[model samples]
Target: MAHQLPETTSAPTLFTHSHPQGIDPSNPHELSASLYNEDLAPTTRKGRTWNSYSIFTLWANDVHSLGNYAFAIGLFALGMSGWQILAALGIGAILLFALLNLSGFMGEKTGVPFPVMSRIAFGINGAQIPALLRGAVAIAWFGIQTFLASQVLSVMVIALAPGAASLQQTSFLGLDTLGWICFVTLWALQLVIVSYGMEMIRKYEAFAGPVILVTFLALAIWMLFESGFNVSMTTGESRSGLDMWVGIFGAAALWVSIYGTFVLNFCDFTRGASSKKAIVRGNFFGIPLNMLFFGAIVVVLTGTQFSINGAVISSPSDVVEAIPNTLLLVLASGALLILTIAVNLMANFVAPTYALTNLFPKKLNFRTAALISGVIGLVILPWNLYNSPEIINYFLGGLGALLGPLFGIIMADYWIVRRARINVMDLYRTNPEGTYYFTRGVNFRAVAALVISSVVALLLAFVPALHVVGPFAWFLGSGAGAIVYLLMAKRRIDLADIDGEAIAVTPKH
Candidate 1:
């Protein structure tokens, strides 16, 4: 594997390598870097650039989650019509597309993961806070996603044996006996795959992504034909023009917030990208096109279910449960179960591993991070914690507040202030003059903005008077944080004038 060092005297970073002592001379592909050590970097490889289709596959993995399904159906209950929901979906996706483009550029340019990239804006030491925050969030979500995957597993098991359905009646620590077993099983399975590392995750995602697409299309077609194309169900939200716009914005903001955590770290994966061309191509196919197509199928199938069954069905398990033919039901449930697990591992599980590994590189390596997260998730029993949307709303909202400000401050610093230039060596130095170093390995300015903005948004989310903008909690927090940081930092730190040579930039963990 080839490694590119930061530029020297206007030359683009040149590929340079001298092996470290005390390590076996191993193949680049096989060598794993120290958790927090900056010396080990991703190897450059040929033909690793993902094309547009591959990007679409990534979205397929991201969008096919149980949480996504529930979100789609939840739109119907918002009091709008079908068309309004479609509009919201479309508009929201567009916003998300733009956001992905913005955040992804740094990744493509730097070829580093999110945590590493943070060294540019947050300083090497300051970067750890955001890394930990992002990683911690991923950890929580990893557990939640595992719980969701397990639900589908339980559904499949119970479907296979009607007698086993009785397990649902018995409760232990908020989950039933079957729930505990399935949760642990899925938890363990993810641990194994994630333990194998990113390569295995990529391979599993590539295949599972295509399979889920085919399955979803088939299910949509079957529903439309059976329920009739023109069938109508419940009246959705946003019937009026103004209301529709609100819903559209809300929907778009929701998509942005849902992905806000990853948006900060998208560079993590993109840093490994073969080139800037690959990163752009991937985002185009993955974020916009993929989300729209998936959203369309989701709406169609969910709508059909409502029209035919007189109730909205969201979870793929619910969709499978609706199948009349027992054989078909079994097959569909099994497929969905597999799909859920794949997405859970890729989107939810793998990310936290990277995040936690970054936080305690020497002590908690990637494997250790994954293990700790799994244990905590098992203890929380997120399955039981997520019994209702209110719970989901609370959890998601709290995260949204924190992530929004962190994202805002980072983006403002990087693109607007730094103008995209960085000193790779300075990133590692603890000198106060380093571009990222603030005071005490932490950026009090950014942290203060984050805390203040998050509190305001959180209040708006919970207070009745602010319910009108309840769904936009993330947008408010991020937007406010960015604006505040920009104004506050403008005079104190001229982001553009920082001498590129004076500030050494290091690779992220």
Candidate 2:
């Protein structure tokens, strides 16, 4: 088969010779240095080292997060019994498992990350739109997560130097002076870990995941014992029948919403999977099972907090701080800090690294982009963004509405519109002749789909009536985007014309 890349004016990346999946050498399509880099290119077989356990650890790190644990605790405060909350979580976990499998399939089979996988749908140059959007979201969240992790550090510092508690009285940019020191401290720590790249991240995650699981599980057990093994299930008035089902689905949707941003770029990790079965096994154990068990732990801790303290404390830090024993407090604080770093690196760090690198492949490799992102994360003053409702709701929330449509359009183009067929070489090359290089390397059809779907999705955010289904905004928006894209694609890739043979174009593993 002929490599379809254009003749480059300058030298292609070193990836041309080093990686088998790079530009072909003989009768080679030398990928342009402007759009091609080793970091963004498909991984070679030797590079795919993540096993089933690696994948499991990935989610374990993500699920055990302080934010996620807090969200789980809030579910019980809504009058739902323990069983009801568990059912809702189960439904949401399965939905995440299913969506991740769908989003990850293309990357796993192709050994390509999310940004490159997007080239098939968004066109090469036009792919920059989603890349920029994803990069912005990732950077913003990265800063916010770092700010959160810093708070955990604050707890540890005071546990050691009790005098550090005085630092809270003085404030700057919504954080105290010592908070700044701790923020940068944790920031530097995460920067060191992220700088080592994905292989190192995978290894650290394997260790962090199991440790976080043990620590949090132990915290829950201790809390259970402190509360005399008495846990309350109901905090508010109970409802059954259709109302109960509504609550269950609503809670399920909310639980799944926590993953809304992460899922769009999930291919970044799944692309390194050692086997298809590994991803399946990992997703099964990591998502529904892990979510269920972790959520159960959160429920136990929160219920016991209510029993012991006679108050509902949802924040993990608050719950931990309330622990009377200094020894347990120190250990739990350290565990929370580890999980925060694990989740931040896996979720917040990796996406922006790839997205930013994709925009300027010649000037920016993974490390350079990562450094740039980390620096920007510090300068953004993310504490303000987290504290301000107007900015959070309008600015970030508005931009976030696109995540679903971006994901929807990609899924639609890959599965529904194109029916899984793709021209792989075309994804890397910038030539007008390449299959994906539509209309100056931009797909107006996909753009139109995004604008239309985003508008539909945003209605749920603004409209009072639609707010009832706001928990499902991502799901609803994805459906809207997919339907629109499929409709638009009928002219370009006729369903009846390319139904049978098109599947062979993008080679299978």
Candidate 3:
């Protein structure tokens, strides 16, 4: 009954790889064929493909994006000084580091994606809830990011001819004529990239990280030279005095909220890592320092542009498009396309693809699920949803509200309740008697915790009186759920004869 464990997985010698009971990939760990697919299975030792560099590039590519540039400088409108903005970035970095590491642990230790990991906490059948929720949230994010990327192209479109700027006057479905065209154009480009699979996405990410970094730096330098290096911090419509300090902290919470979608599905990426060390090393380089430097540069660019234009510019595309040179505009358009696609693939596309596959594993595969997800992007009206800084935070904060409780339950169940051990085989087993087969194959305690915490969390974000508290929706949901789950589950989780990544892969049944 021995089960193999991943290299970084903490387990006893009783479950060593040299056990007489070797896993049979032919039968494929005897997982219920219904719950198992190539995409849903625990990564085999050799199948663990990503390295530290892969992790580095994944975060680097996402951080250096059009939405993020807008996100970083967006705090300026809330009346924060450069130093206060840096403080917000610092707070966000620490919060995000903990969030990614904790959320990614079960994935690293077991090499199972988020849906499978959910079975550990929510019971086999109940796992579908979070998967569906994450899928919906991801589709919304896909559209939002696509819309942001389209800004760069929209700028290009308007500059192509004098008549193009008039397209803004004609609105359809909340977006102007040029906006709709650019949104669909970038939307098509990202689908092409996502259709190619993870390898091509990886290549795109490696290229994008450097292009955005170099391009943004060059743009920043140009802006600095234009304004004689006089960098201002607060924007035109900033809050005054003590109110400004309050808004700064509130805006800082957005940094964590922005990551709400991926936090629930961090496992989707870490499941492919060679080891936890590789992921940690990559995250260390990719997140905190990268955000600090990249955010600072973008903030400076925004400040310089404001000083020159005498107005606030949220998106970087406008600044890049100000130049009348057709060739530079073309080059910048290509770079933004790369940046947007890279982020969409890694952040928005990958997680939902797995979520959808997990839902209909028997009838669906990766590409089919991905194509459906891409189409979902086309229908979403992101132009209206993501109108301003406050709006984006509110949008993501609501997502964090639901995902936060899920995060709490999953982390608490895995680390505290199960002591970081999971029965990987049972996760896929359809039998009612499986280890994870709580009452009717659904953990009511977890469901109760999710409902209660989500209600309180949602109220915090949506209520007019608690607007200041809304930014901490993720924290509130996570803490409330963790507390409730621990109180409700009285049976001590005995860590005996647990399974890990002893399973391997084969074609689905």
Candidate 4:
């Protein structure tokens, strides 16, 4: 499965080519411009039809997850009117779409995973920074989703045998004994999926996403009907005008922050796409379209739950548990729990495994990397991270602050400064003359922009006066980093530095 280096000629740009006969399996580290082999090429194209549906499946898993619903309802609880909540949700979705579209274009252009494509802007070795950060986030999320999924298992277990609730009293690693068992069980299940690698993950998503979607849609309709047509739920109650607006903004910002890890690694999946056009089409359908539908579900479920319980419950698990006899409740909760775990495995667990393995390909392949990441995630004790609502919000917010700027710097370098072009062949070379190897495999400009912009964003998050601005942290950080990187890089490098004629075009999937 080793990738061959791209064939080079005197021509300044590298074009995609299939490897002749057998590929060298020994040197897995020796990657070329097109990080995919013929075996890895996508199978469908624009007119073929199925590719669009497959692409749509990505968001079904993303939106159907427990975390997605939890965050959306939490935003609704913020001090804003119904219109304001809808505005925040819409704005957040659009912004995420733009970010995904930009990142995905690189994948579509290069036909390479995120880590591979990042080599151009981050340098062959320098790409490790973003890779590691993204990997860490993924691992953390893997542990978290496992814990959340286990809670559903706990519910089912307790329902089956009421005595099992006693296990909750026995403490281990800050979680109850039953919680530990469930976490370990879900963790083991994820390993099984991760062992199969990317293709299986895709297939799992293709299946899980659609089933989960259909079930959730049915669940939402049932809840609305059961609760009656006049379920009254207000968005929020703000103390003052400014406070209300600020809180609403923060709520929206939180949604963007939740997808920080996904935003970074989306290219990993998109790289398999046949074209940039397909990538944009996928993002358009996936982000905004999915979010709109997902929000509808959240609002309906939120209102129905309030009417039934007299309090807003953000977690879908809590909402599901309230329904006494409904089969739909049991099915929807179980499906969501499974779907979230699947997402955790696909989105969070898989990225770090591949990214870390790419860092040390000589000694490690996919399995070793996954084992290391799983162990690291366990060491983090993700259940502890989820113990407090305030702590979880701050933790996610902190990560988002860093991610916003990192994305901005990378995108600015690739799109604005490089003008959507890269020396694909040169990306593999360690030689200083290669386009990516600037000053000992580091570009201080990108690094500086990331640090400065992240600091600004963090300040916005923690400062009391600036806390009101926290909801806009991602926008501020991303905008600042992109602007700074584009401005600074423009002064040092011109469009002429990139060969526009070198656009790589491979045969359609």
Candidate 5:
């Protein structure tokens, strides 16, 4: 007989079955004390409070960062015209929106973070491996973003006070005294805000989103008037016809790859959403529309820079510093600093906190996990990583390869293997007989699939001769993993047994 969860204020809202007797309350496999902890369980209704606007603000905080701004500038360097770049961005944005919604749906319904949801496919213990991988990636990102924000702060400080240049004369760990001061200050500020918890982070994003939008708009308008109307979208030698179309597609792939990491872990945000409709609606407005608006601003600002300076200037700080008006420069720099802080906290800080918490729930809560992640971020010395192209390529490429398979495996298990009928309670089960406990708390099939796909994708990315497949690395890895897992586990998985039914799952010894 199946087991019924005890009715409690903290119990999640489960979908009712036609026959109430289908659930058995006498089974030993039904519940485990070690598994049903509050931190890893489905989020309580009280915690599911984020509305459409909050979700929108989350994406806004993610997209309006220095890295994204720089990436937008880099797209023009791909030999595409302004119109072509815009088209590519639009297409990529739509694809990303759909992907995020698909990934978010499970979290919305189950009210569990990505790491907890991962248990369904990877087994309870196996989930920790992916969680750690994701947490490590988030830490690297946190470090890089922190360094980027600090650079913006440092620039603003030097711009406002000329005397600050003296501080740059002394160097430590490859960064000057002024750089260290700004980095530590920004890093500590993010830690403090995150320590207050998720609600405070949401509030920060909500306020920062509009300010960032206005700041970019103001900068774009200023550049337009300053640079005159003779702006040309074509920078350098531009391709047209078939060549331009190819470039557009390439640009689109690049755009999609930028959010590859977030695509895998977006459920961390959506789990807090009030409803599925809220997440879908928020993603629509936040992703494609926001990207379109930001792309237009970037194009105009970049075109104006080319027209005035006879060269492309993608760095907002550099652009601001070039302004002859000191007051305007200072104001713009301050706005950029605020934008950076918002992005760093929303995009880089929160996900890892949850990931680390999931890893060791009893010992590490969200605040402690965040503090640990922050310490590792400093150890990575991201300022150096940001400057070194070879290191950045290897690190990001390796991460993409790793994350792609994980995305594929989870989506395949949920949508195909389980046919969207996840036994939410089973996700937390620690019993050897639990459906998710494939073999000693690990799913070897999924791990094998992840390894095989990641190896192929990494080879494509790093091998000089196989460079032709480099652009499609994310798709290749994800598709390979999904197909492999489906083929291997098709007969072993029993979907009908998921909905309030008890089935003996023999452990593979």
Candidate 6:
């Protein structure tokens, strides 16, 4: 049975459209009655919506994390100079911006979250596989980010009370007593925020983003004053021009790999966007311009590290630990901790919660799903995983490899195979006659393409013989998946039958 929507104000014009031929508004049996549930239904325009600024804040929260800071500084070790590194980051940012816009447009048009939007390409039941895969990766990241943030908090605690260092002597589950305290504290905080739902999450990021930017700027200024102006930007490595260029490209690929998962799941945030223009504008500012500024700050601050501390400092926490003033150390640590929490909530927590909810909408709502994700995050024991580079590489690299093919398949389905025309009602239907219910409610062609591409990419990433292409695995997989899916689905897809002007809506079931 379908529940009736409340008698509220009408939705905006962008969301209002005539029902498709097969969808009978008076007869719920012919509509997507099963999917009319709150978790899977299209968002009503009258509900809370995000503008360009909100969208910008989402990326701001994602990019301004301790891990991203470390990643930026680590690029210096790749044998590239200041300008070369900036250029690589800039190129990567542009590519990211373009990809985000494509994914965001899909969300805005459909007014549906990533997992729901995925049904268009993967079929109603088949979409759960990708959704669960993405959720598991996000859960792992949630644990990793939580562990990283707790380390910063532990530093702050030890700085405030020097005697607290004694807690480090007692260890359990690969973490000290103080470490467990901080980790559980941070974990509890994130769970509370997510429990309030997406609106609260949006407000939290909006406030945290500006404060984080300012704090980072302050850190950069402090470093500049201490190091003075005579800092070397060169790596002092004698490599040919071709080798340098290759290194620069490799750096760009690394940056792409870092955010590849977000690129695939961007529709999660963009689903709440007020309009397409707002999402596009937000992505442009949030990605390219924001990254350029961030990269410049990292380059300048890191270049002077040799003068300040006699060596380049890759981790931000290391720089904070070196500070002599306890007050300054506490302030910096708090800021870093807040930034980490913000990133973990947006990038790691929300996506998986929604994905899990999509998987079991009847049994689990947002809050329940979030709690489940949090428990799994702790169960992963991410501190152990973080300490081992081999494990981290295999885990994150494997996840990154899958994202590229997922992105490729979704994009090809939306733009090329379907020509941006979706049978929105059919997406939620279980009937065999429905357009999307291909072969037991699964598109095997897409499944095969994703599997084949991911396997090839993983081989390149893990196998020692093909290590040369490991860095660019994301690009290779995306290309391979796109080409393969297009070729396989060319005959089966009917662009003529699709209605381009149709918009998705939640019919009363």
lDDT: worst 10-residue window of model 6:
500-509
- For candidate 5, give the lDDT: 0.76
Q: Can you give the TM-score per candidate against the true fold?
A: 0.84, 0.90, 0.85, 0.84, 0.89, 0.90
- Per model, state how many residue pairs clash: 20, 0, 0, 1, 2, 1
- lDDT against the true structure, per candidate, is 0.66, 0.79, 0.75, 0.68, 0.76, 0.77
Candidate 5 residue-wise lDDT, 77-123, digit = tens: 65667888789889889889988998988777677777877888888
* Candidate 3 off by > 4 Å: 1-28, 157-185, 234-248, 380-400, 497-502, 506-509
Q: Give one digit per residue, the lDDT tens place, for model 2 in 386-470.
A: 9989888888888888888888899988887777776555567666666777889998889999999999989977788888889
lDDT of 1: 0.66
In candidate 4, what are the lDDT values of residues 1-509, reduced to their tens digit? 32332243333323233224433344222344233332222222331222455566887788668877777777666545445666667778887888778777676555555665666666777777777777766777778778778888888778767899999998976999998888888788778777766666767778888788787787677778778854545634534577756665666677787777777777777755656676667677877888888877777777776776667776767767766775655676678766976688767887888677667654565666778888887888888877777656677657656787887888878877787766554555555555776778777767777777888878877788986566677778878888877766634542333231132323232
Off by over 4 Å in 4: 1-50, 233-253, 326-329, 388-397, 490-509
Candidate 2 local accuracy as lDDT? 0.79
- Candidate 3 lDDT over 1-509, as tens digits, reads 01221132332343223213654434433456567766677777666667778877888888777777777776766556677778778778878887888877667778788888888888888998888788777788888888877877776666667688988899887888888888888887877776666556666777778887787788788889989998877664456677766666666677787787777788887877788898788888888888788778867887887787767677777777785678787787777777787888888888788788888887666777788898877776777767766756676656657888888888888888887767676787666657787888899889998998888888877889997687777777778888888888646654553544455542121
Worst 10 residues of 2 by lDDT: 497-506
Q: After superposing candidate 6 on the true structure, give the runs of residues whose Cα lies further than 4 Å from its correct spot.
A: 1-36, 238-240, 490-509
Better of 1 and 3 by lDDT: 3
